[model samples]
Target: MAALEGRGLRKQFGGVVALNGIDLDIDTDQVVGIVGPNGSGKTTLFNVVTGVHPATAGTVSWQGQDITNIGAHRIARKRLVRTFQQAMSFPGLTVDENVRIAWEQGRRGGSRWASPAMILDFVGLAPLGRAIAGSLPFGSLRRLGLAVALGVSPELLLLDEPGAGLN
Candidate 1:
C-alpha cells in the first residue's frame, strides 16, 4: 500500500473551485511536489490533504487508512505535517523557544538525529536563536517556521512555499 493516497479530491470556496477530482499515490520513500500558478489550488490541495481544511469531496488515505476530514493535529500525530507560506510562529517566543515547542509537541519520537540548535542552523536561523520571533522580518519568520516543522520529524513534509519571499 502507498504511504499516502488521495482520490477524487475536490475543494471549493464559495463560487470558486480550487481542486477538482485529483488523484495521488505516493510511496513511503517517494517525494512529490505540487506546482502551479498563484491561486491554482496548490495550497488548497495541501490544506485538504493535511487536514488543515476539509475536502468538499473525496478521500485521503495515509498509511493505508482513510484520513480525510481529520483535524490537523491528529494528522500531524501520524507524522504527516505541513508548513504554510505565512509565518505561523509564536510571535512572543524566541527562535530557540519556537523550535523547542515544536520538538516537544511533535510525534512520540521526534528523531533525535539532530538537536534544536542543529535544526536552526540547518535553516540558517542559528544566529538568531535568541532573537524574538515577533521582531524578525518576514523571511526570517518563514525560516523559523520551517525549523519548527523540521523539529517535528515529519514523515511527509508539505511546504506551501519555502522560497516565496527569500532573496
Candidate 2:
C-alpha cells in the first residue's frame, strides 16, 4: 500500500486554479520531487497533502486511509510531517529547547525529560543547543526546522523549499 496518495486533487483561489485533477502516489522510503514554475501548483499540492488547505475536489489517502480533509496537527500526529517554504522557529526558545519540544511531541505519549541530549546530537546541534534559535544564521535555522520535522520520525516528509533563501 502507498504511504500517501492523492486522486483528482484540485484547488482554486477565486478562479485561479492552483491544482487541477492532480494524481500522486508515494510508497514508503521513496524520494520524490515535484518541480514546476513559480505558480505551477507545487506548494498547493503540498498544502493539500499535508492538510494545510482543503482540496476543492478529490481524495487524499495515507497508509490506505482517507484523509481528504483532515487537520494539519492531526496529520502531524499521525507521522505525516511537512516543513514550510520559509524556515520556522520559535524565537524565544533555545535550540535545544526547540528540538526537545519536537522530540516530546513526536512520541505522543513520551515524557519530556527523556534524552533531549540525544535529539540535539542527532540533529548535529549539540554544541549550539543552548543558543537561541532566533539568533542563529539562516542555514542553521533551516537545519533547525529540519530537526523539528524529524522529531516525529515521519513516514512522509514534505520539504517545501529546504533551500529557498540563503546568502
> How well does model 2 score by local distance difference test?
0.84
- The candidate scoring highest on TM-score is 1
Error of 1 at 139 (Å): 0.9
- Model 1 alpha-carbon miss at residue 133, Å: 0.5
RMSD, candidate 1, Å: 1.4
Task: Encode model 1's per-residue lDDT on 1-167: one tens digit a residue.
Answer: 78999999999999889899999998767877777898888889999999999999999999998999988889988989889988889999999999988877664574753578888989899899999999999999989888999888888888889897765
lDDT of each: 0.88, 0.84
The C-alpha stretches of model 2 lying farther than 4 A from their native spots are 109-119, 165-167
lDDT of 2 by residue, 102-149 (tens): 877767754323576776676577899999999998878887888888
Alpha-carbon lDDT of model 1: 0.88
